[model samples]
Target: MKERHTSLLMFGLIASIALFFMLNLVLGSVEIPVRAVIRVLLGEEENTIWRNIILKSRLPQSLTAIMAGAGLAVSGLMMQTVFRNPLAGPSVLGISSGASLGVAFVILLSGSIGGVALSQLGFIGEVTLTLSAIAGSLLIMILIAYVSQKVRGNVSLLIMGVMIGYIATAIIGVLKFFSAEEDIRAYVIWGLGSFARVSGGQTTVFVVIMLVVLPFSFLLTKTLNLLLLGDSYARNLGLNIKRARLLVISCAGILVAIVTAYCGPIVFLGLAVPHICRGLFHTSNHAVLLPASLCAGASLALLCNLIARMPGFEGALPVNSVTALVGAPVVMWVLFNKRKSER
Candidate 1:
């Protein structure tokens, strides 16, 4: 019965994801008929404009949102499980800040030297931004991993992550201060976060990276489940606590880095989705929660993308705003009720 219920829930979530994904294709800046979207996807659409919009824009954006949301949410679940803290996340740990700092250098420094708009640099711009994010995030991730090895206390490690994020932000602020207005505006737009920013080619690369990394994360399911039993117990069970911690953190950090590089610092999906999955399935098992978080994350992101691009808005709203807006209330409601039940 329990397994049956879980299967039903998973099916429901997948159905919702599919529905939202289709809606995203159909209801963009210019609403196309659902049938037209189907025809375009099937290579039968006669209108090049509709075909282009569906193929080149909405499709890529939806795919980006799917991967970004799933990756971040799963990373968040791993962090919360490893750190044993409900609040620890990619942004909270300064990893996203590091990526942002890296992008800031590319945008601010490049603009300070060359007058060309970073956004207008096309494919070259995407590579530059991605490389910058990878460098910045990996630097912070290495620091955090080193600190994890040294710091005996999880709280201390958590605090160190927050401090690193602040340091990254401080550096970015300095870069922005001396940068040109146009560069600053570009950086600001990037910071606001948009799934639509990624081109079809970029989206393919992003999806490929995510596909490789996500499977590795799932293979760590045993390690994650073991860690929940406390360090001593897990160690007694022959788990190398330090190695496991470092491995999980590195994987999670890489996931965050990639998503932040491509999608911007997507805030709450990572932090909130784990909690939502846990509540829905009523399971602490990584085996279940990991996949559940992935599905829930993808569904929420597609929904957010849809709302951001809804008719009246004409996709004017930033994706970060919608995710944060929707995520914050959902988390608050769950936490509040959880505390109430605990009392």
Candidate 2:
């Protein structure tokens, strides 16, 4: 009966997500009618501008919202499970900051160097930016992991992650101080967090990266389940805790980095979506939680994207702002409730 209920909830969430996606297609800056959008997509009408807006602008933006939502949510769940911190998330743990720093360097520093466009750096720049971001995130993850092993307190590790994030942000501020106006302006625009920045070709790259990381995360479900049983119990169950941790971190890192690169920093979907799913489904089991979070995240993201196009709002709210509004309240409620219950 419970299984059937979960299936029904998932179906309902997915249906809502699909409905919102079509709505996004219909409503935008220009407010194309739904019938016109369908006609444009079908190539039944010869409106080039409408066709371009639908195909080039709205479609990619909506697709970006889906991938970013799913990636960040899953990454958050993995980190939360690994660190055993409800607050553990890509943004909170300094991972997203690391990616932001990498992007800032390419956009700000490189651009200031007379004639060095990041695009001129080509595949090399892409590799460098991606690798540097990954390295920065891994450094923080490893530090937190080590602290978790040494300190014997979850709060301390979480605080340490917060400190790491601040440190990264401070470094970024220093970089900004020395950057030229034009480069700084470019970086600031990117920092506002839009789903419209990623091109169609880049979407293919993100999809491939996600596909690779998703399987590893899925395969680790058995280990993850045993993990929630505590280290000693997991060891007794023949799961190598170290290997499990490594795989989880690696998968989460890749997904987080990819989303950050493509969509800028998406805040809170990761931290909030998993908790929402847990409450709705009443299970910590990764099998159900993973898929449930995916649907919920996608649905919420599409909803937010739709709301972002609010009537008379200037140029849509930044994606991060929308997510933060949703995620922050959930975090506060969880913490306060947990504290009260503990008392």
Candidate 3:
């Protein structure tokens, strides 16, 4: 009976998510009727404008949102599980900050030298930025894990991670101060995250990166489950603790770096989405939890993307702003309730 109930709940959530996604495609900056959206989707295009809008704009945006949502949520789940802290995330580990810092340096240095936009640098800048960001993330990730070994308390690790983020931000601010005005302006604009900025080609890049990393994360399910049983227990169970930790952190860094490269720093989806999944599903089994988080994250992001297109705004809200706006309340409620339960 419980199994039947779980399956029904999962099916319901998936169905609702699909419905919202279809609605998202139909309602955007220029409203295309639902019928036209179906036609375009089914390749029976009756209107060129609707076809163009669906294919050129909404489709790519939706795809990017899906991949980003899944990637970040998985990263967050892994980090929280590895750290054994509900609040620990990609942001808390300073991984996103490291990526942001690398992008900032690229904008500053490249602009001064060649007066070229990083996007204009094409594959070269993408490669450079990705490498730098991954390097930065790995460095911070290692530092945090090391500190975590020594720190003992989960709360102390969280505080250390926050301090690391602040240090990275301070360095970025100094870099910005030294940067030329044009470079500073470009970096600032990039900091305001956007899903629209990811081109179809960029989406392919992100998809490839994610595809390479996500399976490895999925494979770590057994190890993750073991680790949750505690380090001593995992060792007794013959899991290579160091190797498992390294693999998990590396996979997470790759996911974080790719999203940061294409979409800029998306804030709360990584932090909040997995918690939502856990609450809804009432399980921590990664096999179930992982896919559930993916669907929930994608649905949440698609909803945010839709709201970003709502009328009465001169420009769409940044994707980060929309996610934060929605995710903040949800996270606050969780934290508040958790505190109350403990008391």
Q: How well is each residue in 1-343 modelled by candidate 1, as lDDT tens digits? A: 9899899999998999999999999886698999999999999999999999999999999999999999999999999989999888767779999899999999998977887768779889988998998899989999999999999978899999999988899999999899989889989988988888889888999999999998889999999999999889999999999999999999999999999999888888999999988877878999899999999999999999999988788768999889989988888887777777667
User: Which candidate wins on TM-score?
Assistant: 1
Model 3, total clashes: 0
Per-candidate Cα lDDT values, in order, are: 0.91, 0.76, 0.78
RMSD of every prediction: 1.6, 3.8, 3.2
lDDT accuracy of residue 198 in candidate 1: 86
- Which stretches in model 1 have alpha-carbon errors above 4 Å? 114-117, 336-343
- The C-alpha local distance difference test score for the whole of candidate 1 amounts to 0.91
Q: Estimate each model's TM-score.
A: 0.96, 0.85, 0.87
**Predicted structure 2, TM vs. truth:** 0.85
- The candidate that achieves the highest lDDT relative to the unseen native structure: 1
